[model samples]
Target: MKKIAITIIKFIGFFLGWAILSSILPLSSSENQAIWRLWAEIMPLLAIIAFTFIFWLIEKKNIKLHLFDNPVKGIALGAITGIVWLAFPVLIMYIAKIIDFDGTNSIDLFPVWVLAAFLNVIMQELLVRGYLYQMLKQKHNIVVAAAVTTALFTALHGGAFEAGVIPVLNVLTMSLLMTVVLEYSGSIIAPVIMHFLWNGIGALVLDGVSLADDYPNMLIATFTGNEILSGGICKMEGSMIVLFINVILTALFMFLKNKQGTK
Candidate 1:
């Protein structure tokens, strides 16, 4: 109980710091490409730098840390986790009649897909899944650790941007999935990559036009149809497609975990 309390308090503090910084810090306007180049472009890098020590400190350990027994195997496992995390959600959104098309777009300034892929798969993975997740898991039960960490993850998005129960359900489910990824691999690294890729695709590549866009049948966001879907509950719920995707990928993750456990 005491350990859990400490973990919860520290978890809240870390995110409070991050959220305050992110919200108060001057950021380039999302609309301004030049501003994005100047500000948004480097924020992820800054976050990575900040998190390195912050996460290290959270674990109360030296800089060198290794959750996985094998380095090469960990990397491979992490990559596979990333692939599943990214692939399934998109597939579910598509199959459930949530998003109509592939929803890929071209931006003149950068190779949006490449950048998005890198940012989503690497940057976020490093911070949330790699650092924070590991730190929390050591102190709390897996479910608690995952939930707290993921809540921070979702909250960092400046509160539940999507409205309705669907969006909340989606985040909760994804959080558990991510937690499983981290637990199964015995490393936060794999799940972190998965997280980064998933969001990068959702924010940059898709351009806020997804299955939820057409079906607003059960979504709640103040800014629904905009290029960036903000401030409402997401539409991961009420869509059988996304649920199906989650079920399959979750099973796969578990299967791998069980295999490794028996070994």
Candidate 2:
């Protein structure tokens, strides 16, 4: 429990620092966005380095030292995890009628937007699941550890929102899926890459919006056809189809895990 407490403290501290820095930085504008984005990329890496070293120093395990044991497996895992994890947000936006996706015609920013989203995912996964998740898992079972880390993950993103409850809840759900992937894949790289792809393709390309928005969504720039499924967040997240797919995928993962455990 003491280790868990310390891990939580470190996670909280890192988040607080990141929030403070993000507030002071100019990431919103087109001119200085690159610089701030670089900072976003660097800050988390530094945090992971420092935090992992600290955990190693105290735990004597140096679990992080083995983070790169299987590079190929990690990448593959990340792709699978990303596909499964993105199922929920895709669901809520499409099936629940949670928010309206007004089109904004942001085709121009596609390239840079994709880059930024991927970088965001790589750094975030490294920090939350790669570094923090390992530290916490050392002190608890998989389920408990994943739960705590997922909560922290959600808090880090949703902390910036006004409708705090929903965003946090959404993030937590996403984190749960991420945790499962990380565990099943046995590495963080897979999830990190997948994180990049999902945000890049799902949130930015298809959705054509920023995840930071209070329900930041794809602006329905123009509707071509299939009004029920064409424009808006549906294109980005894929309507009710996303939710059903996730439910099925998550169940499949659970079944696989159980079967593997028995073996």
TM-score of each: 0.66, 0.67
Query: Residue-wise lDDT of candidate 2 within 69-178, one digit each (tens)?
Result: 56898787777666655655455445655444565653444455555566667667766776567766765566666877776676677442443333333445556766
Local distance difference test scores for all models: 0.54, 0.57
What overall lDDT, based on C-alpha atoms, would model 2 receive against the true structure? 0.57
Which ten contiguous residues of candidate 1 have the minimum total lDDT? 212-221
Q: How many residue pairs in model 1 have overlapping backbones?
A: 16
TM-score of 1: 0.66
lDDT of 1 at 157: 47
Q: Candidate 1, residue 97: CA error in Å?
A: 6.9
lDDT of 1 at 252: 82
